[model samples]
Target: MLIATHSGKFHADDVWAVAVLDILFPGSQLIRTRDAARLAEADFAVDVGGVWDAAAGRFDHHQKGFDGARQNGVVYASAGLVWKEYGGRCVAQLAHECCGQELPPQRAQEIAWAIDSDLVQYLDMADTGSAKNAPGGYGLSAVVSGFNPTWIDEQMAGSVEAAEEFRLNQFRRAMGFIREIIINAVKYRVGALLALDQVRQAERLEGGSVLFLGNAALPWSSVVRNEMPEVLFVVSYSMNENRHMIHTVPVAADSFKARKDLPKAWAGLRGGELAAVTGVEDAIFCHNNVFIAAAVSYEGIMRLARLALAEPDPRGA
Candidate 1:
């Protein structure tokens, strides 16, 4: 019989679980990875068992699959027993146990009280906070609404040292690229009208950004939503003397589309040549006119511009 447990963290319970499982079935291999490829060979699996409290007679059965595995193995015991015997009180307790030292009574009591008072809920809330209001469609407004100004005042007034916190570095990097794209588009008068239209569309999409570029005979232009992480770019240019077209580029799927010109003057701007832009890197340039745009990632734009530049100039080339 094989028993497999998976967890994002190597907690004390994880170590205990492995030790108990090993004692039960010697020579069973323990494996873990952030990649899915590592689990391809496993035929059976068990999810991580949550914390168990014996003092208060409470068991956190939120995790699934443990009971079934236990029944199949004929162990048939609850998490409470597992935690009481094997789980450590805290990081310190875990370290002490590993070092062959007994956990202090005060620390043990703290862990017990933590479980009883649902301190895990606080940790869970912090984890959700780190997600930056993305979970459950909650926005910054929701977070601000629940925040306590008094707590902030207390923390600032207290003697204890406080650590500085900042938003995820990746988010800042993405925003930098967004700002560069927007400023460049505005400076070149690239897609002002289309940008406005895309902003309206994004408003309809519930605060999603859409990049728009290309119309009549202009270069690409992008528009991003104010609150969401999205980009839309559009490109439109004339392909023939009688026909004008419009094209739209979505960030995801790298998709583009073109449609035939309608009777109205703006109709020609409706359908431009469309192509999936790919392999764009740090900078994008139009070889024909030497037009260049720089950003953290411009691989998609570069590919589109190069493709357009390669096409024979309909007038003569």
Candidate 2:
């Protein structure tokens, strides 16, 4: 199989599309040329062909009247187009390659959807020149653009092929960066799935509003906030220094505003001062913003969690 994209000034969308093809069709020959004859000879053409025939393995998105978008309405670039056709299978392969685990079909679909929402969709939107929801200039597109070699930088080289070499090297660098990101994303997701049972184990603890865990690194937020809504705090013990941590459930993943924060009095306190106010022995510190608190002992943190749960809240009594 041959994976082809436009030869000059590659964008993030085509770079990623070719990268995905490398994963989907291992050992496929890659050709970078704008010649119609060269593009037509390839088994697959992306970003340069000006066609959107999935059946024909052509996945350009710039053609007139080509109105392809995901269900969420972000228009498809070549990357998104290829993702729509091959993301699930490629994600499953990535899970195995990066995480050493097999992804069930349903789980593969979940991961594909997640990567699309979090990463792929934005790449598509950026390539299409759409306005970003967030403040501009800190996305995958900007990072990939940095890989482009400046003309002055290449002009110093004596060889006539320096410009050509510069573009290819820049393309390789971008491809490597994206490949690492894709693998790490899949690996982290698979690791989260593996840790769900541990979180569930903590959930079965019958007690106050806090769930306790022996492992501080456990990903308890999603399992607790989404699955068991009543959990207000999660106390976890860390073996490194025999410390314990208390975490408040945020209203959302990106939001710092907690569903139930630590007591306002305990905010920004530390050492014996924190212990004195919270009435918990060995209390280490509490953040100024009240999102998290630390204690010197598991026993101390558990008591701290219980005490904070009883503290007055703006939302209720």
Candidate 3:
């Protein structure tokens, strides 16, 4: 199968669209040109073919009367259009390539929806000059565009064909980079879902305002916030032979304020001084901002958590 898109200055939308297509249609020849007749000759077209017929394998979203928006209302770009068609299958294929196992049918659908919401739709917004979620506008677009050949660099190439070849090499590098990103993202997300059971089990044993995790390697913040809001402090016994950790639960995802802060006196203290002040002989350190503390044993970290809770609440009525 032949895949076609426009030549000249490339953008993130079409670059990613073509990259994903390369994965779905392995060994498919990619032709970059703006000639309508030449694009029509290919089995598939994207970005510049000016047609939005999915059945015909034409996947442009630039037609004037075309209307395609994600559930969140982000209009389709070429990346979004292609993802809508084949993203789930692509996600599953990548997962299997990375791991020798296939995702359950339900799991594949769930991850595809997430990829659309978290990644594909975001790219659409970036491509169409629409913004809702990104606070800092420059994201993946900046990274992709940075690969373009500059005037000075192009002149240094000595010929137009050489510059084009250099640009093509950059695109190829970008595709490899994009593949690693997508695969790793799905792998971690799947792993996190698998770890939720561990976090929930710890939540059951929690008492008062503290939760104790037998093992600290798991990502626990999302579980704590969504499943166990009553937990104010978490004391985790890491695999380390001699160290445990304590942390305050943040008030919100974007906020620095915690549900409860560590003792004001312990903030920024360490070693013998911290241990002396907190009266915990095994105390190791407390961060300057009091969000975290370390201790030599499980009991030592527990003491740190209790001491932090005991500290006066300046807001108390």
Candidate 4:
């Protein structure tokens, strides 16, 4: 399979669209050109063919009279156009490759829409001049644009062929970065979906005030803050660190403030000092901010949890 995109320069939209196709169709030949015959012969024409047919694998929004937009009115760039058709497949592919799960068709589509909403639409927005980059030029679109060769670099190439070759290499680098972003996004969302049920069924202790998750790696804060309001502290065994952990539940998803913090006396204490203060022989360290603490054994963490629960809230909530 051959993938043809426009030559000379690249943007996030084109780079992202081509990256998605390259991932789905590995080992495809990639060419950067505006030659009509070359584009006609390619299996996929991205950001150049002046066409917008997904079934035919022609993904471009530069054609005349183009008015493709999402329900929320974000215009379609090559990124959004290709993603609208292939994003679900991309999600399913990544889920299986990265998370080792075959996501249901509906679930895959849902995640695709989520990625579109969270990321693709913004690329489209920037491409169509419907939105501006972040003030500091830190946006992904800006960062991708930065990968283009500067005038001095192009001049140093000394010839059109050398400049084009250098530009192609940069485009591939941008593709590699975008591909990693897609992989990580799919992995995190799939992991979150898989963990929802486990979070819901986590063992409740201390009259439901403490939730014990068997695996500390599981993401529980959003579930605890949103659904399990009664849970103030969570105790889990961290397999990676080989330690038991106690975590204070945050009052909101984005807030750093916890619903109930560990006792102030235990703040910044570690090892023997923490054990002496909390009276848990295997107690480890408590973070200075008191949002989390650790112990060597489950019993030690449980004791710490009980001690924290009995202590009056410093805020007197």
Candidates ranked, most accurate by lDDT first: 4, 2, 3, 1
Question: Which number leads on lDDT?
Answer: 4
Give the alpha carbon lDDT tens digit for every residue of 221-289 in model 3: 888887787888888877865589998888777788888888788879999999999889989999999
Question: In order, what lDDT does every prediction score?
Answer: 0.32, 0.83, 0.80, 0.93
- Expressed as tens digits, the lDDT of each residue in 1-317 for candidate 2 is 98888876887888888888888888988877889999999989999879999889899998899999888789999889988888888889988887788889888989888988888888888889884524667677887877877777678755647776778878878888888888878877788898899888774333647788889877777778788777788888889868999888886878887878888898899999998897887999999999889998767887888788778898773
Per-candidate RMSD vs. true structure? 23.5, 2.3, 2.7, 2.2
Per-residue C-alpha lDDT of model 1 across residues 1-317, encoded as one tens digit per residue: 34444533222222333333343345666544323444444432322334334343223334445342222232212322333343333323433433334546654444433341232222223332322323453432233223222455436645432211111122223223323432332223323432455444432211322233223444333333232234322333334432222133333334232111111211112112112122333322222222222223234443443444344444351
- What CA RMSD would candidate 3 show? 2.7
Task: Assess every candidate by TM-score.
Answer: 0.18, 0.90, 0.87, 0.90
Clashes of 4: 0
> Which stretches of model 4 miss by more than 4 angstroms?
132-135, 314-316
* lDDT of each residue in 1-317, candidate 4, tens digit only: 99999998899999999999998999999999999999999999999979998889999999999999999988999999989999999999999988899999899999999999989899999999989646569899999999999999999999999999999999999999999999988988899999999999989999999999999989888888889888999999989899999999989877899989999888899999998888888898999999999999998899999998998986879
Q: What is the lDDT of residue 235 in candidate 4?
A: 96
Deviating ranges (above 4 Å) for candidate 1 = 1-3, 6-28, 31-86, 89-101, 105-107, 115-119, 123-317
284, model 4: CA deviation in Å?
3.0
Count of clashing residue pairs in every prediction: 25, 0, 0, 0
Residue pair clashes in candidate 3: none
* lDDT of prediction 3: 0.80
